[model samples]
Target: MWKPILLILLMIFIGVVGFHIIEGWPFLDCLYMTIITIFTVGFKEVKNLSPQGRIFTIFIILGGVGTAIFTLTKLGEILYEGGINRFLRRRKMEKKLKSLKNHYIICGHGRMGKTVRERLEEEKLPFVVVDNNEKKLLELKQTYRCLYIEGDAAQEEVLNKAGIKKAKGLAALLSSDADNLYLVLTVKLINPSLFVLSKAMDEEAERKILQVGANKVVSPYKLSGLKIAQGLIRPTLVDFMDLIIRRKELSLYMEEFTVKRDSDIVNRNLSECDIRRTTNVIVVAMKKPGEDIVFNPSPDIKVETGDTLLVLGDKEAIDHFEKSYLGGIS
Candidate 1:
């Protein structure tokens, strides 16, 4: 791909230097003559050439013209093989993102945001990324069949293109806390029910995010410190949870499901709901809207409308449970 281009450049340089030396022409005139001779554009020379310059023109035409043709052909092949296909593929991907529903919108492709995207993809979750960096998005496409949009995430048009109104959640992991906060505010203003988790650079940003209706705010540095402490204090528990979290490699996984207002099992106690008997899935905890999560929810705890159930079980069991009873996870 590159060799032909380099050779063409070398040929042009030789032609310019030759004309300047043999014909005593200025650099600009020499360059113009070289271009015309190489492309066979049928333009007369800027000045009459010396006998030596005429001889030099013959060699320049031989080397430069052939090399130029080869370079053009190679470029044409490259465009046909890769560039055109990539453009068509991007158009197809945009259509998919525009039609997505109950999906996630990830804003940013920096380190933290990329990590979040990888985990979501590993779990087979549907999501489309929004970032202003087309190069980074291109790199991501080379590795994964991920959908993305190139635009400023803070803009309403970009968010709408990502289908933010129908999105289940938004992960605002922009490079700066201020940008993430602004994104969270914009998203929530447009879709108040959409869950938003954002990254914060400082305590003030964290407070502002929630003030703007972000459902959760994360400080990656703080989480790293807490994780290091937990690793030392409770290694066994962390390792066990890690196994359950590896959805692609492990059959057992942990997920949350919502109880609809009209579910038949609503207002019934956990014992009577008999989730374990029917689906073989364990309910690890349950949280009502605006309430604290009840860890290891007691058997007497009633399954109520608007309760979120965090369960751990095999894939088949969880699917069966979702199909039979759970409304959908928010």
Candidate 2:
């Protein structure tokens, strides 16, 4: 903006001074002549001019027209590239992120974190990714439309921007163990109620991670070896579970839902709730807070708040059960 203004002012000054010196016109008359010439108004000159003045007017016109065209072009590019449209889109995204509740935050975008995000998408869960990798963010934007903010995960400001206070959970999957530990600690301090999951690089880090308030710690290397071992002995069982869980096109998948405080099913026994009869969904297990998971819970077990129900059913059935039974708390 300043460039075009200064250039045009310099051109006009040169025109005015040259005309005043060459034609010996009054200062006002020279200024008027300069303005008319630069604008190509074709008005009559203030006074009859020498040949040198006409040549100078010709130069003024050329410079003024060139500067005007350049200014307009640069202004157009600025408006198109860094103007209101980009700002509005960014504001819209920020507003949406702020309004998110019960959404998960993924603190890294490495291989493990990307896989976690894919699984979340498969389950139709909302999530946001926080990382400092511009290239990874660009690639993720192309492939996934979930909310993402680029920043240091260990920083409270970044977590607050991701709505950690309202977020249901967060996963710390940064490359380094120290960073993940710091990220987990920060999240716990910000929202102690929020469930935290962190990735562990070393076996010794798992205990430290739990002490730092991570509810669960995942180590991809450890899980891969277990899966391989399971496949060797329980091949058919593994295939069956995979067929049910991995094949989303099928009518069955495993899911979990939290029992809310005011849910209708709270304090009611499983048989009384009659989940299978009403929703045609199986309640595979239930875990009370600080209690062991009761696999294939009995009909007489009572539901309670903070209990997580592991269920297996179709997507629509799960949604219906969650809404109608969980009291729509989320």
Best-fitting candidate, scored by TM-score: 1
How many residue pairs collide in each prediction? Answer: 0, 0
User: In candidate 2, residue 135 scores what lDDT?
Assistant: 81
- Per-residue lDDT of 49-85 in model 2, one digit per residue for the tens? 8999888888888888787677768778778656766
What local lDDT score does residue 191 receive in model 2, on the 0 to 100 scale? 96
- Model 1 has an lDDT value of 0.87
Hey, what RMSD does candidate 2 come out at?
A: 6.0
Roughly what TM-score does model 1 have, to 2 decimal places?
0.77
